[model samples]
Target: MNAKKEPSIWQGFKAFLMRGNVVDLAVAVVIGAAFTNIVNSVVKGLINPLVGAIGTQNLDHYSSCLSSSCKGDQGIHLMWGSVLGATLSFVITAAVVYFLMVLPMAKYLARVEARRKAREGTHEIIEVTELEVLKEIRDALIAQRGSVHDER
Candidate 1:
């Protein structure tokens, strides 16, 4: 009787790391980290300055006191400004990734699929026409064979 040995942890780990998705995920993480700097710069350089024209240049500086007679971190403070800045950064990043990367890739893949389907449709039509022609020939051959037998 033969017994199968289970894979060791190291082998399993090696397999996991070698999978295509794991490599793709690693690349995406590195690219995302680099992309984050660009988004932060856009927010700090452009958005913050535009907002600064109306108020403070930094969003982290803006806050609201929830309690009366509060002084110097002695009361409940709502850091809505930081939240707003983070929200803006997230929106900008998502828009850039979608419009610049995801949207174009989706469109390109769709075009490729359409071309493949068109080629397959043409091949199918040819096959069906050929089948019909073969059937017609078969019927004509049977008729000719029947006429020859009648003459006998």
Candidate 2:
């Protein structure tokens, strides 16, 4: 029993590992991590400067102090502005991708897929009731019987 159970457990593990989604997700995670560096560089190099020029100009770079000394333990300073800048850049990038790239691609692909499906002449399934199935079978049997009787 234990031997049988171990093989089944191993089979389950193999099946899980072989799933397309699991592999796809692992690749996506790795690629996304690599892509993050590119995103950050674009934010820092180009977007940050442009935004700065238009607005407060590198306001996020500095933090204020309640007192002069930022010595060892006590200071009332916050880098909330940099956090705000990073947040804004992220939001803007997301918006641009959603509006400019993802939205249009999704609509275009959907229409193309619809057209392809139409050309292929595949249709949606309509569920038939049990009565409908019985009626169809009855009609077929009657037609067969009529043919057989006519021959005799």
Candidate 3:
């Protein structure tokens, strides 16, 4: 007897790539890579020089010495500069993402949610009022009818 063959892993991967979520992720990755250059430029070109312009002249490089042999010896590794650069990059990226994308998206979503809540609130009010009116009508109908004896 002949059996149907299972699809290969590569074929499955290809199908996954074709899915909307996968495609969107791929696009986002490319965009993120492109955005990296802009953020990097801001950090390197603008922030680094601004820091350098400050009294310390490369503020990142300026650090207090703390060593065993020479209690106040300057460290060979300028670790603070690297740290400052990283911090600057983090701040810039966070600011850009917040101002450019996250804040606006949040406001838009808030507006949409508020509109939905308004619609739902109106519907709920109408439903509750109708239910109350129906209850009143039902009680009137019962009152109009003579009370029946309860059969045990």
TM-score top scorer: 1
Candidate 2's residue-wise lDDT over 18-64, tens digit each? 99999989996897677667777777787778777866556475566
RMSD of every candidate to native, in Å, equals 1.5, 6.3, 5.8
- Rank by lDDT, highest first: 1, 3, 2
Better of 1 and 2 by lDDT: 1
Predicted candidate 1 versus true structure: per-residue lDDT over 53-139, tens digit per residue: 999999998899998856888998999999999999999999999999999999999999999999999999999999999999999
> In candidate 3, where is summed lDDT lowest over 10 consecutive residues?
68-77
Give the Cα lDDT of each candidate. 0.97, 0.76, 0.79
User: What are the clashing pairs of model 3?
Assistant: none
| The best candidate in terms of lDDT | 1
Q: Per-residue lDDT tens digits of candidate 3, residues 1-152?
A: 89999999999999988999998899889988888899988876777677777644454566544553433344544457667777877888889989998999999999999999999999999999999999999998786664553332
C-alpha positional error of residue 119 in candidate 3 after TM-score superposition, expressed in Å: 0.8
Mark the regions of model 3 whose C-alpha exceeds 4 Å error after superposition. Answer: 1-24, 55-76, 147-152
How far off is residue 26 in model 1, in Å? 0.8
Q: Name the regions of candidate 2 deviating beyond 4 angstroms.
A: 1-7, 54-60, 64-74, 96-101, 116-152
**Residue 37's lDDT in candidate 1:** 100
